[model samples]
Target: MSVLERFSFNHATAKFWDQREAVEACARTGSGIGLWREPVQEMGVEASAKLVQDAGVQVTSLCRAGFFTDPTPAAIDDNRRAIDEAAALGAPSLVLVSGPIPEGGTIDSAREGVKEALAVLAPYALERGVTLAIEPLHPMFASDRCVVTTLNEALDLAAPFTAEAVGVVVDTYHIWWDPEVWRGIARAATEGRIASFQLADWITPLPAGVLTGRGQLGDGCIDLKRYQETVDATGFGGPIEVELFNDALWARPGAEVFAETRAAFANALA
Candidate 1:
């Protein structure tokens, strides 16, 4: 099969897409899908799971379930629900975006909070057979978005746990600028910690808030093909998820955006 055969589209790439339609599209193309919690909850987790099951679409990973930079009982409970949802959907991984630095807290303290939260939740995830994939967002988002900003840092956070229970997400848009990314990928592979692989280009002149500015595949400066090769070289055989958070793409029809994203993914790999 072609390399693109393993490409999976993250539903958040087209943020407003009907979940069922996106799942159906993946089924049609024989591709996998990465789902988000809001939409899945809107449809009800069990209903969402049944939809993907009926469509024969593989749920590659759940979009997120980690804001426990300052873990609370509620935070831990919420992630447990997320893990349950992932298990119900047959998704092997639950992607995590470590929450921002807490009020009056330093980044260092926030990272410690993440470790504590993981210590509490990792066993829960392990029990349910879901891997918690810590996603290191770009440095630009460190203060207000995710505290984890490097693969190495994420790996260190995951180091205390078994590979099956905790891992890291290697997304091009997030870590492409890290000088040690190649080495990080290698280490992640050696440790069996690569749970999710996503593609999103790094574009400049980011929009306000910078949350919705993720560029489409091949549209920006990231060497996506190189990332694919590097990850493959490391023996990571998981789905390569295309996950652009661009407003322009979201404003279009979901099916149209899905088609374009899939084409861009195939071209990037080609």
Candidate 2:
């Protein structure tokens, strides 16, 4: 009865730039990985898939697909391609970061757009056996990155879709500050909507733009064990992915970062 099997490392943890090294590192650690789209595309989806398979690493989830706040036909089309890639990699879910409000548009309008986009792509995702995981970003990213800022909001958005086609990515870093987070986690479990569960510590005086300021495990003010306990209490036995977007960690060697991150993750769970 341990959370180790539930642990994974997001490629973004090592840095968004180094793709191959990150995969190899994850392989060395005997953990699963959360892959980003750009690297997969650059290395060629088939090649990347082969690399991961050869390394014996499980791909927990694909980093993204769902920036369709405008619900453009082209956006939906792109998301379809993302689903194809996720299926190709044998990943169970494609994490979706619902896009922000378009200029002159309200958040409500943006959310509606997300609904429409999901309607368009969810079928395709289901066909390919890829679950679209709507990731609720921090409220601070509500404007430019993702409007889905709370677990409740993400769950509400996903309520209309089948769990096979759509679900949610619960990242503790983004949601640890929410007053109603535990309730949301329980709700996700009851609804069977917990597609992915990730981790990252939160730091203050966030850097400018604030997208990459995530702290390493135990470096900030998050109660890591409480997260594990809460999610486990709900019978959510999914991979606990560590997805840090810290700039400093990115500057170090991938091997060092991987080892340190794995240790940090173990420490947090311990």
Quote model 2's TM-score: 0.96
lDDT by residue for model 1 (166-242), tens: 99999999999999999999999999999999999888877774788898888899999999989998887778998
* Best by the TM-score measure: 1
Rate residue 155 of model 2 by lDDT. Answer: 92
**For residues 33-144, what per-residue lDDT tens digits would candidate 2 score against the true structure?**
8999988999999999999999999999998899999998889889999999999999999999999899999999999999999888988999999999999998888999
Evaluated with lDDT, which candidate comes out highest?
Answer: 1
Error in Å for residue 250 of model 2? 1.1
The stretch of ten residues in a row with the least summed lDDT in candidate 2 is 1-10
Per-prediction TM-score: 0.98, 0.96
Model 1, residue pairs in steric clash: none
Off by more than 4 A, model 1: none
